[model samples]
Target: MHIQMNDIYKAFGANQVLTGVHFDLKEGEVHALMGENGAGKSTMMNILTGLHKRDSGKIVIDGEERYFDNPKEAEKHGIAFIHQELNVWPDMTVLDNLFIGKELRSPFGLLKTKEMKALAKKQFDKLAVTIPLEKEAGLCSVGEQQMIEIAKALMTNAKVIIMDEPTAALTEREIEKLFNVINALRKEGVSIVYISHRMEEIFAICDRITVMRDGKTVDTQMVSETSFDEVVRKMVGRELTDRYPERNPNIGDTILEVKNATRQGVFEDVNFSVKSGEIVGVAGLMGAGRTEIMRALFGLDQLDSGEILINGQKASIKNPFEAVKRGIGFITEDRKNEGLVLDFSIRENMALPNLTSFSKNGFIAYKTETDFVDMLIKRLRIKTESGETSAKNLSGGNQQKVVIAKWVGIGPRVLILDEPTRGVDVGAKREIYQLMNELTDRGVAIIMVSSELPEVLGMSDRILVVHEGKISGELLKNEATQEKIMTYATGGQ
Candidate 1:
């Protein structure tokens, strides 16, 4: 089947989100939708999926016009969406979440729990995963939650599957497994609409790519005919030669040190140090204790036995408040749950950790709080309607910027970034890299944990490889290679 979206025009108040945008997906083909944050990609997709009614558009499925009033209507027509943010309840079991809206019910108005559980098992088996169906969805890791979302889509027997950043939280192994599943779906004549900021994944998995820019359809072309740089240029409206900002060579004395850091079953005996003005990239396969170490250092988790010294003086940190007081900040990987407050405004979230700076008489100084947030928004280039806008309203990239802006406003001496660019676009990633450079130039040390090898190799002054909850090896900037890092990451050291 071929799906055609023609003359799609949508508007929110005075903002014209999509101006005559168009997209197409062919049968059994992986079609990629590429654009920068707030480039109208999501708006266009929302229209197609029936989450929002289009002001003007024609959706043609195999020459027949279709208009879906709601998401259930779209799903009934074999169209399914796996949203960027995970949509599973922590309180519900995996089985319940998988069959949430489309539960199997008996004719007598009773819930058919056993049949739904059995059906969930079948889908998991097809996906080659073994998640405990009875376990709470919240207990599962982010990667597992992602897997459950995919399985939920499959339960609808969807002919057209829309995946928005499906692999953003997945490990290398999980990504491979997901790719295998996608390949299997293609063989069965299922079409895919893949939206992601990762260029490599688009080149590897997609057949055609549709580029959108500033609420307009820029171009649609085959993957084999176009280049990655050309696509990036189309999205950002500029030529980006250097994917990462040039590294600053100025290094100084160690600013933060963790000696013999241990967190029991989480990690063991970790030893590392970050120098002032240095960007230390931590690399390892998933579950290699990289995140755990950062968490412990940030006082999110208490180290079972370890010594943390800041600038040659031993420091005691019992919680995040203490960590912040000690001039340390962490930009967590799970931004939605850990790094941001969805209900709070952009300025409100920024004012959270640094409220003391804006208060003198126990009452918040709204003007001071907004001024600080405004400055950071400008410095970080965060795209928002206003500082009063809710954090949830901003795009993924902008939300990430807000998180950084909050920490930077606090003036942390040492910043810990966990997957800083996991789901952001190329333009945002480059901008963030530049921000990192600026921070380091100001003598603020940074410890970055990343799963992307190229990002680590390009931006870091040094690399630390972790394996099985241990610091397996360390490599200088010039000496580190993907192969060498992999060797150490797999316990070669």
Candidate 2:
């Protein structure tokens, strides 16, 4: 299943995202497409999977030139893509999800329910995935959801499979399982195109690597023959020294303190304190109550019992308004759900948290709002046409910037970021990391909840691991590692 994209050219209005990008994927091999965020990686994937039409290109699959009108056409030609966002329906069971569009039928055209369940089970068993077949897709962990997406791809009997940032939310152990599954697929002669920002995973799983920068193909090399630094330099087009900046040892008074926080079954006994000018990372496995704890702190969830102290004063935060007034900001994990209003313009979204500042005597001030939004867009390097552009129209990385811009617009002393870079690409991820350092430099107390071990280790001044609704352990930056974090996360004493 060799895939060849010859001289691909694509553009959005005056913006040319992919300029003569060319690459080849060999049969039974894992090929990685590495690039900075907004470097045409997603655009290339969309072109290959038929989500977007290329302006000009030659797509040869198994030596046959074909044009795909849509994703179904690509699927019919043995091509499947598992996007970074899970496409499974939340209300559908695993059995129903897997067989939704292509259900087996009897002679009378009646749906074959038992056959679908058996087939879904067989698919999971074949991959050694242990998720319950009858459970709703939304109830599973992020890693489990990813595995189900993989299983869905396998069910298509695809000869060529494209995985976009598949391990972004997976744990170390879960990542290993995915690697095994990929290897099995390779043994069965399926070619895989893997897109990822993690250099370690790319080197571990990919056989060949193609680097893209500024919408152009920079170089292609065998994974064994290239170094991580060289690959990163190529992707970023510059030397990125010190991925994590050193913290200024200027610890001030505790800005926020939570004592014996409990929210019934969601989380309990979550005790933590974040000081000014420090970054505290909450590290844990998926569904380990990390997000729930943050939600309680942000006054988004009802707490059964707890005490919240802001600036050494006990404060009761009934909702986001009160929380914001107390100098607290929460950037939710689900950006689409809680962070940004997609239909609103960038100016409207950015000015949402600062309506009071942009209002004068009960009247909205559009000029002030637009001025602040423009400043934020420029400061964050958010690539949008204007502040008037709709939030939904921006790319994934740009949309994340919009969310951050909204929070920064209001001037928060205490910031809470949940999975800040969950599915962001390489370039945007670096920008976000640098932004975090800038925030801490300004004496802002930052609390981050992340499932990625590397991010926890790289960015945090301190790490707290949670297990089954309890704070299991805390470690200084010097003591935090993948092994140490996993030990505490799995209930080790």
Candidate 3:
């Protein structure tokens, strides 16, 4: 399939999303769409896939102008979108999810279970996915769920696949497998619209790149012909200084410590400590109990047998409220569901944790709340029309900033950040790193659980590697390398 989108324009009320955006995808090629959050990359793709209607544009597919009425109609014509958030029905079996809404049926109106399973197995085999078809989709790991979505698209015989941030939650090994499948799909004449914030992955896989900024096309170049610096400049409309901000340590005494923290089946013997004005990074593969340990610390999950010490004194954290009251703030990995209320306005979401501070005599102070939200918005450079705007309307990077801002509002002594910059762009990532430096400078201890090796090495003062629910090894910032981290993460000394 060959597609050309010319002069695309879209607007929601007073907010203009896309204007004169041009994008094209050639058959059998991996095309990258690079941009900062709210630069209209996703919006343009949504228009292409018929999820959003374009006000004025020409969509030329195979030399003919075409506009799909809906996503299903677009999929019927061989276009499939695998969103960043995988859409897997938790209670349903994997087979059911794959054949959802398009199940095969016999002449007597009975379901064709055998035929569906056979077809699903064939697609899974092609993608090298080993997930059992009988297992519940919700039980699958993020990587497995991603593969299921890919196999589901392939099962539709989709010649054009749009993958949005496909590897955000995947481990290194899982990412390699996904790359292999993408290569195979390209060879099979499947065109891909690969949208991601990871520059390394973009250069590694994409054949051609299109840069967008402020809802307009900036430039399009072959990946081999363009440089990373050049693409970033095009995307952000300026030269970004560093991928990570500098960290000058003023290490203090331990602020929080977990001694033999055991969650039984989830994690075991997770011993670590973070000092005031220090950033301790937890490195491990996905499902290596990295997130589980953080959850236990934040009181989201109970630690079966362990000790949590705050400031050299035992602290009991039975729930999120208690965690917050003890000055321990948590920014969960899954921001959409856990961190923020999507339907609420930015002011409301930011006030959820700090309402006590903004309240007086059992009455809320609206002025104080708005003032605080406005300050954080400006401090974090969150791009939004106003604090009254819904959280769901902002881009991924902005949403992440909102999450961070919400945590910062409580004035925490110790902050736990899980995958802080998972799907954020390069510019916003640097900003977040700068924010971390500022927090540490203000005597805030931080425990960052991350899967990205460079991020771990760059921002952490100390790195702790997790393997099979245990702390495998610890490395100082000066000694930590990607190879050493991987070794420890994979159960090496």
Candidate 4:
């Protein structure tokens, strides 16, 4: 199947999201969509998937023009979308989830449970994964859940599939399996629209690349014809000379110190010290205690035994509020649930942390709140319609910025960021790095937990690898590498 989108234009109120963007898909090939945060990639895909109606555009499928009213209508034309966010319910079985809305029923008004299980099993087998058909979907790991999502797409007999940030939460082994599945699907002549922020994945799997910037389609070139440097330049609308911003962290006195931090069945005997103006990067696999350590330090989790010292003096944090008062800020891994109130306006979300600073005698100061919100929006380069817009309306990258802005407003002596650039694009990532550079330059200590080894190697003054609830090894910035980190992460040390 061949699909073409010409001169797509869309807007919401005063903001023009997509302007004269053009995209097309070829049969049996994986097409990569690359862009910075708020570059209109999602907006364009939303229009293509029938989630939004284009204000002006033409969609031609196999030389026939068509317009879909909704996602269901689009599905009838053999389009399937496996979103980055897992849509499966925790309590529901894999069999039930795979055939939830579209079930296999007998003509006599009876459901075919056996057949549903068998069909789902078949899909899993093809992907070389064994899934208990009756097992609850939520009980599965993030990687298995991702495979289940792909199986659901195959159940639809989709000719064209869109995978958005499919490997954001997948492990190294899980990622390899996903690539194999993609290859098998391509062999069967299925078209795939692969959207991701990882440059390696684009060059590895995608045949054609399309770059968008500021709601416009910039360029689409063959993977073999372009270099990573060129793709990044076009996506960000300028040459990015450095992937990681230059930082000469002025290592000062130890600001935060952890002594024998232990959490039962989570992490144990974790010891580290973050000096002022230093970025300590934690590198580990999923469930390896990186986030667990941070949680314990930030007062989000109970510690079996630990001692926290701030400014070389013992400090006790019984709760998050106490941690905040003690000059500690945490950016949680789960942004949607733990970080932001989706329904709240940007104005409320950004100012939620500093209400005391912007208020007096329990009376909120509207002017002070607005002034601070405006400053953060500008400082973080957050793209939004207005400060009044809901946080849910922003892109994933921009949503992350809101979380950062909220914490940065608290003026913490030490900041802990978990998966800081998980799903954000390259351009926004550079901006975040710059922000970190500026923060460290201001003499604040930062502890970042990330699964991306390259990111850990690039930004950290030091890298700590965790393996099975223990700090396996620690490496200075010059000594850390992907192989060295994995050696420790896999319990080698």
Candidate topping TM-score: 3
Tens-place lDDT per residue, model 1, 1-493, is: 6899999999877677889999989999999999998888877878887898898979999899988888889899899999888888999999889988777888998899998888888888888888899999998877789999999998899999999999988877778889999999999999999999989999999999999988899999999999999999999999998898778568999999989999999789999999999999999987788888898888888988989999999999888999999999999988899999999999999999899999988988888888888999888878777898899978777888888888988888999999999878899899899989989999999999998889999999999999989999999999999999989998885
Question: What lDDT does candidate 4 reach at residue 156?
Answer: 94
Best by lDDT: 3
Per-residue alpha-carbon lDDT of candidate 4 for residues 294-377, written as tens digits (9 for 90 to 100): 988889888899899999899888789999999899998777768899999999998987889988998998998998999999
Candidate 4 regions with alpha-carbon error over 4 angstroms: 91-95, 105-115, 125-147
Residues 1-493 of candidate 3: C-alpha lDDT, one tens digit per residue: 9999999999988999898999989999999998988899888888988999999989999999999989999999999999876689989999999999999999999999999999998887766677899999988876678788878887888999999998888888888888998999999999999999999999999999999989999999899999989998998888988888889989999999899999989899778899999999999987788888888888999989999999999988989999999999999877887889999999999999999999999999999999999999999888899999999999877888999999999999999999999888888888889999999999999999998999999999999999989999999999999999999988877
lDDT, residue 429, model 4: 93
By lDDT rank, best first, the candidates go 3, 1, 4, 2
Q: Give the TM-score of candidate 3.
A: 0.97
Query: Looking at model 1, which ten-residue stretch has the lowest summed lDDT?
Result: 241-250
The models' CA-based lDDT, in order, is 0.90, 0.86, 0.91, 0.89
Score every model by TM-score. Answer: 0.95, 0.95, 0.97, 0.94
Clashes per candidate, residues 3 or more apart or on different chains: 0, 1, 0, 0
Encode model 2's per-residue lDDT on 1-493: one tens digit a residue: 8889999999888888899999899999999998876778888878988889999989987889977889998998899999876678888887777887899999999998888888888888877788887899888766788889888999999999999888876777778878998999999999999998888899999999999988899999899999988998898788877666555646788899999999998888889999988999999887788988998888898789989999889989878889999989888877775789999999999889899998899999888787888888888788777898888877666788888889977789999998888767666777788888888778899999987788889889899999999999999998778888989999998
Give candidate 3's error at residue 99 in angstroms: 1.7
Q: What lDDT would candidate 3 get against the real structure?
A: 0.91
